[model samples]
Each structure stands twice: as structure tokens, then as C-alpha cells.
Target: MREIFIERRDRILRIAVKEKGQLYECFIEEEEERNEPLCGEIYKGRIKNIVPAISAVFVDIGHKRDAQMNMKKGRTYKQGDEVIVEVLTEQIGNKGAKVTEEYSVAGRYAVLTVNRQGLSVSRRIKDERIINNLKNELVLPNDVAVTIRTSAEDTDVLHVNKEIDSIYEKICDINEKSKYILKPQRVYGENSLLHKVLIDNINNQTSKIVVDSKDDYELIKKYIGDEDEIDVILHEDYRTMFDYYGIEREIVSLRHNTVNLKNGGQIVIDKTEALYAIDVNSSKNISHGNKFDTAKNTNMEAAYEIGKQVRLRNLSGMIIVDFIKMRDDKDKADVLNALRKAFYNDKTNTRIYPFTELDLVQISRRKKGKSIYSYIEEKCEACDGHGKRLKLSYIENLIRNEILRVEGENAINDFYIELSEHYEKSVKGDIFTFLKEIEGITKNIYLNFVPGIDSFKVEPLLFKKQVENLAKYKVNNIEFC
Candidate 1:
């Protein structure tokens, strides 16, 4: 059974899909209140410059950076030409948003393509009769092209044709209004995440859809529109739907570098500036006597987990996986085949190449938005983004200086110092002595320990004035005292 859970977390809407209790996919979208740039927004952009050598053009789309459009062969563009484009991918790192000339507006049943001429059906639907019916029966405008989506399958023929007609008319209205526009503008913005999730997966084998917010539940009901097979549930329980389904735990685990497989194996994922490196590790010896069989089994497990992790984390760019060494040619082929099959359900464009001479598998996936790591984790200030800390004595001296500074202020009766559990253990003796000295001066001093915080905080209990003294001291790894 498939279940979808939607939760509104502050200004972000998080969606998680689970199939038979395992997380299949997850998405994070900013709420409309935040007014963030979405994936499917259409913009009328003016061409700023054309680089013929690269076959790419830069356009001013009212974003901080110019959007890039990769021109196809025989396609010509001139400066100051106003072209309508859709955002293919959002800005990543220093690169601008990737835009495309071939724009598509997606509806629940079909997607209307502008300028691109072709009637295509989703590859998932294998019924030739259904494909032939859609191809022959659906009527679209001459200029507009339509692609029958997977959701169109098993749906009423009249409903599918009506939806196609409605989307075509909507695009026609947008084009008619665009004739009067003189500058760069947005032609259309995609629907909210809730609507998008329902539209994209309504025809799938989803048995239940749960939303925490009543407003969003109503919105989803309106989008589903009289479809009663799928249960659209409004979860009014105090516990969130994510918590109820244990999806929150899975999301939290995405931050970890290691993933444990079912068969006593693990995969470690490391993200660098250029690419993602994954290493497969077998924790226990296989019960099977044959080493090749054990390696193949572990490699197959890693391949499936890699696909799941890539989707869960929304990892993109080049990925290199170091699978357990398999000596047999057939074993290598089997592993590669497993990897390809695992990514069949992925929505993003992904290409997997065979193993290299060094036994590393190379895979490339389309990057649509910020990675999951960047979304959840921030650069550490104390480590200066290196993910390491300075010497213990250096931190201790920094703490001493902070205590002295607070003691000199004499504004409050008590002082509180908060440090991470690790740092607390390292400086316990020094902290005790410092607290005793401060107690002599102010008659009240306290030390608190917190987890995961490398730096320490010093504050006056009465005045409520806190000072982060780690910044005032320079980091010296070599110096001890």
C-alpha cells in the first residue's frame, strides 16, 4: 500500500511518500507566503547575449543572475529578442537558473507543450489499446502539442479530453495576453506543492493521502475533484502525520553520512564540491561459502540503497560508487543491471555508465534544486566550514577570557556557561576552577552542557545578556596553554 503525508512546517511544506512502510520519495517546497522561485514558473525573458561557441544564450529574467538557455541546433536567437521560457532548474551554487525554449504546462491528465509538436504518452502505461485510444481520440489545437500523462490511464475518456482542452485553452489565453506585454514578465506560475503532489500521483496506487492542515486538506479535496477511490484524510490528531508514520525519523537520518543496509552492510555518502562519492562496506561475512556470490549480493543491496538515498537526499551531479570488488564479468553486469532497474521509477533524468577499469561506477543525475544536505545543515562557524574544531586549550582560554569579561561587567549576580558535551568533558577541571573563582566574585556561577555545539556561550543569568566569546579568540591548533 502507498501512503502520502503532507505537513506544513513554518514556511515550508514537506511531502513524503511511503510504499509499504518504506519511504519512496520526499519533497520540500517553500510556502506561498515565502514567495520563492519555483521549478515550473514561466517567464518572458529578453536575450542579453549569445555565445555561439557554447550554443548557449543568457537572458534577463528579473532574477539576481541571468538565466541560461541552451539553444538547439539550427535554432537562432538575437539580442533583445523576447522569448518565453520555463525554468528547467533553479540556481545552484553560483550558476544561474537553467531555462528552456521548449516550454510545457502540466495538468493533472496531460501536459501541453508550446512550440514542441508531438503527441506522446507516458512510457509507464504499457496498454497499446489505451495508447492508441489517447492518440486517436484526444483533440488538441493544431499549434499546441499534448502528452498524455500516466494519470490519464484508467481515467474516463471524456474527462481526459476535457482536461486537455482546458489546458490548451489556458495556454491560449496566456499567449493572447502576452501579445500586449512589452517587458520581461512571468506568464504563469505552477500550482502549490499540495496540488502538484495530488496531480502527479493521483492515478498511482496511492491508497491514502493525509494532510495535517485543514486548509490544505480542503485544497487537496478540491484538486482531487469527486475521485473517491483514494482516501483524502484530514489528520486532526495531535501527533503529526509524519510522526505517526515515522517519516520524520527517516528525514532526520538523511543528515547522517552512513546508511545501514538490511543485510549487515552499509554505504557511506560524502559530498564534495565537484561530485558525490559513495563507498559500500560489508560489515559481516556472508553465510555463503562463495566470495563472488557474497560480493554480488552486497553490491546489489548497495545499488538499491544508493538509488533510495539519492532520491531521498535529492542528490544531483556526478556520483561515483565504489562497490565491493567482484571478479566475475557476469557479476559486474548483474550489479550494473540492478542499478539501472532501481532508478526506473525516478522522475529526474539519470544516466548510469558501466564500471570503470578501477571498478568505480559513474552515474549522473539532473539537479533540480538545492541538495538535501544544504537544506538541512548549515556551515559551522567555529570550524570555519572545515567540520573540525580548534585545540581544547584554545577553547579553554576563550572561555576564560569570556568569564573574565563577564566578571568585569558586574551587571548580574550569576553567570552561566554552556558548552557541548565533548568540550565539557575536556575542560571539566578548568571549568570547575573558573566557576569557583567567579563564585568568589559574584557569589553565583553555573556551568551547563549541551550536545552538538562545539562552541561555548557565556551569559549573565539576571541581566539576560549573553555573549558568544568563541569569536573573540583566534584559533591556534598548535598552542595548548
Candidate 2:
């Protein structure tokens, strides 16, 4: 059974999708993004600068920075001319948002495009009857286009038609606003996180929708009112819905580099600036008798996991997977087939290529918004993105050296080393030996465990009385000689 669990906390909404009680996907929406227009929003922008060399223009879209857009072929826009634009990507780092002149509004089953005028269907929907039916059924205004989403396949005509009408109405509204709104600003935005989760994930197989927030429960209940088959439940447990459903643990696992498979195998996922690389390792899989059999089985398991990880992490662009080497050609084919089947239902446009001569399978997935890591984790300030930190032993040695330097200057004996409580506890045993070694050198070397300090700090006190006075308060986790 497919179930969606939504939990709102700290002005952030977390949505987790589970199939048969196992986590399938997870999404987090911050409050700022929920309330403000970011990506996938239509705006009325004025051309600020036109770089003819690059064939791109910068437009003032009322954001902190102007958005960058590629010039549409045959379309000329002078400075100060207004144009309707859609945000294709959000402002990332030093680069401004990437916008497109061709504006489109997405709905559950259809996307209404204001610039492109034609009826298009999702390539994933292959049924001739469904394609023909959608082509004939969806009605749009002249000069407007609509693309039938894959979710519309085998859907009720009424549902698809209703969504089309809704999206077209939104397009009309945005267009109307663009005409009168003098300043560059957003005209239309995508629906809320709840609406998106329901539209994109809740299908025939989805049996239950659970939300911890009462307001969210009502909103979801009202949105899916037409569908009586799906049950919307309000979780009343004291624990957050994610914790109750084991989704919190699953979310934490996403931060790790290694993922364990059920068959005593593991897949190590590494992301570089250029592309993502996944390596499959067959460990302790003795159930398979032969080497070829074990390689194929582990590769198959990794293939399925790769599909899930890509979606869960929102890993986009080029991805290469190195699977266990198998001699049999048929085994490779079977693994590739299994990989294709795994991504068949993915919403993103993912293409899996045949294994290369180097025995690596390449995949290219459409770039979406930021990956799950961007939302859930931040780069470690200490490591500076290198994913490593200074060893506690090294830090202890550095602190000892600093004290020795101070001792050489014949400084006051009443000295205190202030460090974070966490760091202090880690090196507490070493601190005892160091204090004994320096007992004769310094009258009283004190240790102060500041709550939020990241590293150890050494300071020389003028008088022993001062150290005694500071220790009287006992506010910090301080240690005495």
C-alpha cells in the first residue's frame, strides 16, 4: 500500500511517501518557499541588459538579483520592454534564477503554456487510445497550448478536463495581470506543497494520506474530496508523524554516503560537482553459489536502489553506476532491463544507457530544483566541504603546544582553557594527564567548557584570585585543577 505522511514543524513541511511501510520518497518545504514565489512562477519582467554575444538577456524580475534568460529565436526585445517570463530555476549561489520567455503553468494532469500553441502529450503515455482521447478532449483557448502529464494516462476525462480548465484559467489570470502590473513582479505561482504532493503522488495505489497538522489534514481532505477511495487521516500521536512512521530515520539515512541493501550488499553514492557516481559492492552474499550469479544479483539489487536513491536525493544531471562485473552477456542484459523497469514510473525524464565497455552504466536525468541535501543538510563549516574534521588528538596536541608557548613567556600560572562541552568530554581523559604533567609549571591550570564553542581556546589569567572568582558562579561546565 502507498501512503503519504505529512508533518509540519518549525515552519517547515516534510512529506514522506511510503510503499508497504518502506520509505519511497521524502520532500521538505520551507516556510519561505511555501509563501513566496520562487521557481515555477510566472512574472512580468523588464529587459535590463541584453548580451548579444551570449544570446542571453537579464531581466529585472523584482528579486534581489535580476534573472537570466536566453533570447528566444526571432524575438527582439529592447531595453525597458516588458516580457512575460517563467522561472525555470531558482537563484543559485552567485548566479541569478534562470527564466524562460515561454511561460507555462502546471496542474495535476496538464500544463497550460501561454507561449507555445499546440496540444502535446507526455511521451511516457504510450497507449494510442489514451493519447488520442487526451488530444481530442482537452479544450484550450486560441494561442494557448496544453501538455497532458503522464498522470493523466487512463484517468477520468472529467478529471483531466477539469484540471485543464483550472490551469487555463490560471494562465488567463497571469496574462491579464502582466498587462496592467507596471512593476516587475510575480503574477502567478504554483500551488502549495500539500497540493503538489497530492497531485503528483496520490494515485490509484495510494490507499492512505496521513498528516499531523490539523490545518493540513483539512486542506488535504478538502482537496481529495472527489476521491473517496483514499482515506485521509489526522495523526493524533504525541510523536511526530514522521517519527511514528519511521520516516525520520529514513531521512537521516539520506545524509550518509553508504546505503545497505537487504541482501548483505551495499551501494556507496558519491556526488561530485560534475556528476554522481554509485558503486555496488557485494558483501557477505554467500547465498548465491557462483561468482556470476552473485555479481548479477548484487547488480540487480543496486539497480533498483539507484533508481530510488536518485529520486529520493533528487540527484539530477549525469549519473554513472559501476556494478559488479559479470562475464555473461545475458546477465548484463538482465540487470539493464531491471534498471529500466525500476525507473519506468519516475516522473523525471530519466534515460538509462547501455553499459559501456568499461562496465559502467550511464544515466541522465532532467535537472529539477535543488537536491534533497540542499534542503536537509548544510556544509560543515569546520571541514569547508571536504567532509573531514581535525582529529581530537591533533586538537589536543595543538592546545598543548599553545600552552607551552605561553609557558615559555613566563606568563601567569592561573590559566584556563575554554572549549566546547562536547570537545571537552571527548578529550577529558587526556586533559587529566596534561594537567599532571604541567602541575609544577603552572600553579592552577583551569578548564572551562563553554556551551557553544567549536574548538579549544587557551588564555592566560593575571591572578589566581580571578580564576577562583569566575569558578564561583559555576555557570559553565568548568573543571578545576
Candidate 3:
């Protein structure tokens, strides 16, 4: 059975879709802290400047940075002219949000476009008769355009027409209100996360919708009103919706660098600033009969897993995958085909190229938001995220150098050296042996241990007269230095 589970935890809303008990898709949204997604939101923007060289213009939309809009042919605007714009993509990293003069409002069964003419059907719906019938039924104005959605294929003719008309009415209302707005402001906001999910997935096969929030459950009920065929249940159990469906475990597993396949193979996913590199490795013990067959099977398995991981982690931008080597040309073709098929259901726009000369498969996906890893994990401070620290021997050498430097002065009767617990424990024997070498010069070498210290600290012992003169001095928690 297909089901969608929604849960709200600590101001974060998590939604997961399952097909036959396996997670197919997952999404997360911060309820209290994050700004609502700006994509598909309509705003009145004032053009700030026009860059003729790049054919793009900057507009002020009340954000910290001005949004960028691409200029089309035969379009002209002054510096202070106010125009309607829709956010195409949210601001990513240092780049500003991308906005467009052309905008469309999407509904469950169709999308209405402003100032454009024609009815276009979703490419996924291939029935010529259904397409023609939808085209004939849609009665829209000459200036307005509509695109029939795939969900309209099985919907009733009256319902489809009504939905189209309803969306057209909303568009007309917006146009009517646009003339009265005097300043740059938001005219329309995109649908809520729950509403968008339901609109996108509510079809004939959707069986159940489970939610942990009673208020959200009631809101969904109000949206669906009389859709009794699809059961929208309010989960009252103590276990979280994510835990109940094993989504939490699945999400946690994606944080690891390596993912193991069922056939004993593994794929290592590494993300860099420029691109993501995925390396597929085959196990030593062959699961399949021949080497080529084993490589092909592992490549095929990795292709599907790679697709799932990309979506689960919300990874975007350039990606390169290095599959297990296969000798036959047919094997390479089959693996590429498998990868293309795996991303067929992905909502994000993705393009996969054929294997290159270096046997690498390249992929590019549209980036919308931060990846799941960045949201969940932070950079380590100790090793500056490099995941390695100085060796104990190196630290010991530095300590010895400091001790020798103090002994060179010829004024120290005794001295104390502080080291981290880890360094002290690891080099206890080394410290004793090194002290024996300098026994004649200063037999009063003192070692002190401190917690969480990354490097060594040195302090020379002062005489009784010197300590009395510096009344407020303390050394290693002792009264006298």
C-alpha cells in the first residue's frame, strides 16, 4: 500500500512517502526558524539596474540582496519601473534569488500561465484521445494559457473543467488586484508544504495519509473535504511517525560516507565544493558467476542506490559517478540506461550524460535548498573539519624543544609542562625517557595534565623570593609560580 506520513518534531516538519513499505521520497521543512520558500511566490519588484552585457536585470524585492531576472528580447524597463515578478529559484550560497517576469500558478490538475496562450498537456500523459479531449474541454481566454497535468488523466471531465475554471478565476482576481498596488509587495505566496504534497500525490492509487499533528490533520481534512476514498488518519500512537515507519533510521544512514549494497558491494559518496564524486566498488568474493556479470550487477545496483541517496540527501549541482569497470560495450550501455530509468520519477530537473572517456558518468541537478548533511551536521572545530590531528610524537617533540629552550636559559631550577590527557597518556613512557636525558641539568621536571588541551604549555618555576614578590601569581593551580 502507498502511504504518506507527516510528523512535526521540535519545530521541524518531516514528510515521507512510502510505496509498499519502502521509503520512496522524503522532505523536511523548518517550521519556526526558516523563511518560507520563495519559489513560485509573486511579488511587485522595482528594477534597480540593467546589465546589458549579461542581458540580466537586478530588482529590489525587499530581500537583503536584490534578485536577478533574465531579460527577454523586445522587453524594456527603466531603472525605477515597478513590475510583477515570480521567484524562479531561491537564493543559494552567495547568489541572489532568480526571478522571472513570466509566472504560472499551479493547481492539482492544471497550471495557469499569465499573458500566454495555449493548452499544453503533461508530457508523461501519452494518450492522444485524452489530450485532445482535455484541450477541447478547457475554455480559457486568449491571453491566458493552461497546462493539463498528468493527474487529470483519470479525473472526471466536469471536475477537470471546474478546476481549470477555478484556477482561471484566481488568476483573474490577481490581475484585477495588481492595478491597485502602489509599492513593491508580495501578491501571492506558494502553497503550504502539506498542501503541495497532497496536491502532487493525491491520485487514484494514494491509499492513506497519516499525520501526527491534530491541527494539521484537520487542515488536511478541510482541504480534501469529501475525499472519503483516501483515508487521512490522525496517528495518536506514542511512537513518532518517522520512527514508526523506520524513516529516522534510513535518514540517519545517509549521513555515512559509504553505503553497502545487498550484493556485498559498496559505494562511497564524497561531496566537494565543485561536485559530488561517487565510487562504486565490488566485493572480492563474486556474487555473480563471471567478472563482467558481477561488475554489471554491481553497477546496476549502485545506479539505483545513487538515485535514492541523491534525493534522500537533497544533493544537487554537478555529480560524477565512477561505476565498476566492465569490458563489454553492452554492459556500459545497460548501466547508463539503468541510471536514467532510476531518476525518471525524480521531481527535480536532472540530466545524465553518457560515460565519458575516463569512464565517468556526469549528472547535473537543479539545486533548491541546503543538503541534508549541512542541515544536520556541523564542521568540527578541533581538526578544522579535516578529521585528523597532530601525532603524539610530534607533540612530544615540541614539548622536548620547549624544555631544552628553558634549560638553555640556565635560570630554571624546575619547570612544569602541561599536556592534554590524550598526549600525556600516550607519551608517558617517552616523557620519562626524555626526562632521564636531561636529568643532570634539571632533575625537577614536572609534568601536568590538562583536559582538552590540544597543544603543550610551558611555565618556568620561580624561586621563593620571586614568588613572594608576585603576590597574585599562580601556576598550574598552585599558589606559587
Candidate 4:
């Protein structure tokens, strides 16, 4: 099992992931910003529609993804019912949210999935006899239910009960205030980013805790003591932490498209306005062995990385994975299963379909707003609405980079650089600069600057190449490629 660590700065909490005694990945929360997530937030809401056919009611939860209630799924309610819903999945574009009436407010100790049955255990919890005794020993409220969180493995009832009571009081106050609302409004919200990080993630791996701000360190320590037995010592000097540790360098690596795998292959993710695409390739230099072995080697790494990317990127909506095809059916099954297993921790509801006739794995994750990556990079004001530049300067940059990549290579003696005039000028000058940067790297550069919706080449240069190879507007040109 993997362990998660947390570092809270300002209102953003950073979650660090590690496995087998080594740091693997991290999730950063910038809650002070407007783009912060409200998914899994619970609030009191009123029913908008009760679709008996689909068995879902459109609920008006406070922020977004107006909760969708599947009639048969959870507690039964009516058209005008005022109920509590925990956001299951976030709002994806115009689509509404998937919600459940069983609400839960989590703390450092346990999660409160309220208004239902009894305490349940995580399926991953082994030593079933011990799990059963823990369940049988715990006293559950008649009107509520809870899924004793993964962190509560050996925790005592006093601690769990205290959290349950605290949550009850807070929720009760919110409910009382919500009664005054003539219509539905978001009354309850997530805790401070630091509190949330500590509550949801325990510091299971990190050997040390360092803090720049006294308040942040105190807050984290308070949660750590309350949640588990671990003692977290705070190093007050944050400058020392950043400079002494490799955090700054590691964070820079996280922002890039390429990710290295344990076995051999690499996962290159590309995104677009319409969809997301993942390419799993065996970086041949690291390949484990023969053709079949190479394909399997790469596929396994891809499967594991695929899950991590989906979570770290918070990528939602349709996702397609182009895996290195394997001849053996068992190999294909193994890879598919690995991909699914990796995603088990993802709270979002994801659907993965089997490989298509083309040997492609199709995944659909709901995405509504700008991806996590886009938030870090400012957009070009010139693109009008998009971040990419179809103008000559931008396309010219891509051409230059491609040429520099192929320079002096025995393979690919020549390439036709087909591009529009807008892109040619915008992208070409950058090529000049790049060629200057790399000596003896020059080749023939062709330019195509035709008008009439030059969507094929220009779009790929921007959106499609991002990962999904997707275009908002379908291009009819095969000539450019």
C-alpha cells in the first residue's frame, strides 16, 4: 500500500505520495484560488427533478454539479424533498453531478457518511476476523452509517466517537442555518485547505515535517496528533526546507508531460479542448527485452502511470489510451486489469471500456474547466479564447523544435513542414533561434500557408498535440499530415 504526506502553505495543501519508502507523487491544493475543488463537499439541497426513468433527481447543491440522485441507489425521497448529499463526482461541463444522499463530513480521524445504517470497513482491509470484531465492537447510531476510513485501522472508539459528535454538531448548526434559506444555497463547505489535507491524508511516509509558517505547522501538528499516534516535529525554517531538500526541482518535473516508469516505458499525456489521450511507449533504451517482452514491459508501466496521471492531473471526461499492442490475450487482460486497479483510489466515477478493434483502450473521465496544468500556464491573449496560437509565430516555434529534434539524425533525412502563414511566421522565427542554440542542426523546412480553415495542421500544433490529438472543429485536410 502507498502512503500519503501533507504540506499546507497558505490555503493550499500539498499531498505527497510515496510507495515502498520512496516519494512517488503529490497533489497540491490551491484553495485560495477560484479554481479550487469542492468535489466531495456535502451540503443541504432541494430537489429539482425526480426522473423516475433514470431514477435520478437533479439536486441544487451549493456550488456546482447540482447533485444527481439515482432513485434506487440511496435513501428514497420526493420531488420537493430537502436532503443532504455528498458530492460523488464533480460537474463535468454542462452535465450535472452524481450525488448520494448519504452525506459525509471527514475529519483527521474518521469520515461521517451520515443519515443511514451502520459502520462498514474498507474492502482492502485484510485480517477479516479482526475487521469483523472491530465492526461488531463499534456502536453505530441508529440513524447514521459510516465507512470507517482506511486510517482508522487500530484507532479507539473514544477518538472516533469524538469526531462523530463534533461533525454532528457542526452539521446540525449548518442545517439550522439552512432552514432560513427560502431556496437552496450552499451552506456547508470544505474546511481550510490545511485542515482538509490533514483530515483526508495522514503523514504515513515522510520522516520529517518542516514548516515555514508557525500557524501552518501548528495546524498540521494538531491534526496529526488528533488523527494518529505519530509525532510530527516542525522545522520552523521553510527556506531551509526548500533549499536543502529537492522539492523545488521535483515540483518542476511534475509540471511536464513526460513521466518515467519503474520498468521501462514512459507515459506521454496529451490533452485538448474536446478530449484527452495517453500514449504508452517503451523508451527503447530502457526496454526489458524481446519484442513481446518490450510490449508487455511498456504496457504494465503505462497501466500504472495512467492511473497516477488521471488523479494528479484531475483529468475528467473521455480518455483514450493507445497502448503498445500485445499478441497474447492474457497480456492484454493483465494490462487492462492493472489499469483498473490503479484507479481504485480515485473518488471520481470513471468508465473504462475494453480495447477497441484497433487495440485501443477507451477511458472517459468527466472534465469541465481548465485542467490542472493549464492553470499554471497563462494563455496567449492573442488566441482570442484559446491558449494556443494558430498565428505564424506559434506554429513556427513547433516547426523549429521538430527540425532541431531531427537534426543530424541518420533517419528522417527530410520532412515537409506544412503550416499556415499565420503559424509559419509566428513559429518560424523561434526555429531560427533554436537552430542557433544547437550548432550543426539544420535541415530543409517546408511551409504551407493556405487559408480556408487550416484546422488540420494548426489545431494539432495546439490542442491535438497536447495529448488527445483532439480538435474542437473537425479538420478535413489529410494533405497537411
Runs in model 4 deviating more than 4 A are 1-25, 29-37, 46-83, 90-100, 107-110, 156-170, 180-185, 190-193, 203-206, 226-244, 260-264, 285-289, 344-354, 363-370, 385-481
Ranking by TM-score: 1, 2, 3, 4
Better of 2 and 4 by TM-score: 2
Q: How far is candidate 4 from the true structure (C-alpha RMSD, Å)?
A: 12.5
The Cα local distance difference test for each model comes to 0.75, 0.77, 0.74, 0.60
Put down candidate 2 lDDT per residue, 1-481, tens digits, no spaces: 8999888775567889988888887777777665444667778999999998999899999877889999888988799999899887777677888899888877778877777788888888989998887777766667877788887885888888888787777777778878999999988764444566787887778899998888888888877878899999989864457656767667657778898988888999998989999999998777699888888889999899988888899888899999999888999999999999889878777999998999999999976567877765544444455653344533454455555556666755666777656555444556555554434233556666677675567777777577777664332344433
Give stretches of model 1 more than 4 Å off: 31-36, 190-192, 239-241, 388-481
lDDT of 3 by residue, 45-73 (tens): 79999999999899888777788999888
Put the candidates in lDDT order, highest first. 2, 1, 3, 4
Residue-wise lDDT of candidate 1 within 11-54, one digit each (tens)?
56788888888988888775542353457788888999999899
lDDT of candidate model 4 versus the reference? 0.60
**RMSD to the native, candidate 3?**
14.3
| TM-score for each of the candidates | 0.78, 0.78, 0.76, 0.65
- Tell me how far the alpha carbon of residue 175 in candidate 2 is from the true structure, in angstroms, after superposition: 1.0
Least lDDT summed over 10 consecutive residues: which range in candidate 1? 470-479
Clashing pairs in 2: none
Candidate 1 residue pairs in clash (backbone atoms < 3 Å): none
> How high is the lDDT of residue 435 in model 3?
55
| Model 2 residue 218 distance off true place after TM-score fit, in angstroms | 3.0
